[model samples]
Target: MTILVSGKNGQLGHCLVDRLNFSDLDYISLDKKEMDITKYDETARIIGEIKPRVIINTAAYTDVEKSEIDKKDAILANESGPENLSKICKKIDTPLIHISTDYVFDGRSEIPYKPEDDVNPKSFYGMSKLAGEQRIQENCDSYMIIRTSWLFSEYGKNFLKTMLKISKQKKTIDVICDQIGCPTYAGHLADAILKPIKKISENNFDSGIYHYAGDQECSWFEFTNEIFFVANNLGYIEKIPNLNKILAKDFQAKAKRPNYSVLDSSKFCKAFGVNPSNWKESLPDVIKSAVLA
Candidate 1:
């Protein structure tokens, strides 16, 4: 089967490439330089040339804080670009696997955000991604919109890498303890992306939105502390410091992030007949790989 992966350099894209290396699938992966989805003509041309049975769109403008000032660029990349890709996929009648985020919800609930929950984005970044979801739903018929959260990987600059860097330079670091969500490893997300595609090819399954993320959730402070603890044990860090806990509002940012962006993965698990490992269990491999790198 011919499958195309966009955002080849991003966290999930990189993970997908590594995971699918030994699979019997013809995959064409492209970074932004190879195919810019922002241009509809370019997107159409590339999709037509590749003729992929499934198009996995991992590309996104993910700078939450910076998006407040760069709304135009954010909208172009997040909303308009996905729309273009959806249109192209629709034209060819190929199934689209688009990645979305938990930020589409307002983060006000005590329970996890379900797939059928109402969307009330609190930031420009969230709004832009939500717009992308809307565009894809309207334009494409055969598509799987997966809403994930707190994605990190060894290939790119992510939260785990940032904390490790900060720990190396400073004796202490302050992280928000109030905001709670899963620290989804990109490799796990890559696996989640592949599951439905295999199902589609084997069973000709119907398409819809699903939430795929790490099994458990935690605050930013807890997640950071775990990173440093693992790093110190793995000899990646010399010593651990006082990890300070702060509230989300204490950290000044241009964008207003969701306070509780945790998503319910029950729907995804049921659809694929697989339950992903929790973040804590899967985090060790990510740390091990990052340490080795």
Candidate 2:
């Protein structure tokens, strides 16, 4: 089997490339230079040429705040890119595994988001991603749109790296306490993606949206504290600073993030027959890899 992955340099994409560890399948990882998925004709042409059995699209305009002012770019990458890829993958009778986000929910509900939950996106980024999901469903037959949240990895820029950087440079930092969600490790999510592929390719599985992430929900404050603790334990920093807790409203941003977008992965676990580890347990290894000794 030939696997084609887009956004090869991204946080999740990079991990997937390094850790997939499959010897039987040939992997073709593409950065922006290899293909600009925003153009439908070019995207379709390249995908049609590759004729991959599985196309996993990880590309996106992921700057949540920037998306507010630059909705066009967000839509182009997140919405149009996936739409084109889905159309081509469907045309070739191939399976498409598209990465989505938990931001599609409006953060109003206290309960964890189900796959069938109504989406009322409060940000341009979320709206664009939701559009991508809709496009895949409309354009494809064999598709797995996986929605994840608060993703971090050893490679690329993410919240964990940001917090580590700040912990080293600053004496004190303020983190939002009101916003609660899971911090999903990219490796776990990437591994989870493969299960569906095997099931779909071998067992003739059903196709739809699935949610996967690190188990356990936490606030930004809680997550940062844990990150610093792990970094200190791993000897990444000489000292850990005081993390001040602040409300979400106090930290103004261009985009409105869901306050509690933690997804219920029961459905995904049942369908895929795999469960993710908790963030606290996953953080130590992540810190060991990304942070210094």
TM-score of each: 0.97, 0.96
Evaluate candidate 2 by giving its C-alpha RMSD to the native, one decimal.
Answer: 1.5
lDDT of 1: 0.87
Provide the global lDDT of candidate 2 against the true structure.
0.86
Model 2, 131-188: lDDT tens per residue? Answer: 9999999999988888999999888889998999898789999999999898899988
- What value does the lDDT take at residue 164 in candidate 2? 91
Instruction: List the candidate 2 regions with Cα displacement exceeding 4 Å.
Output: none
User: Where is the poorest 10-residue window by lDDT in model 2?
Assistant: 194-203
> Across residues 1-293, which tens digit of lDDT does each residue of candidate 1 receive?
88899999999899999978877777999999999889999889888988888889999999998899999999999999999998998888888888999989998899998889999999999999999999999998888899999998887889998888888899888899999998888888888778668666433766778888878889999999888888888788889978899988889877888899889999888878867547777666788787677
RMSD of 1: 1.3
Compared with the true structure, all predictions reach lDDT values of 0.87, 0.86
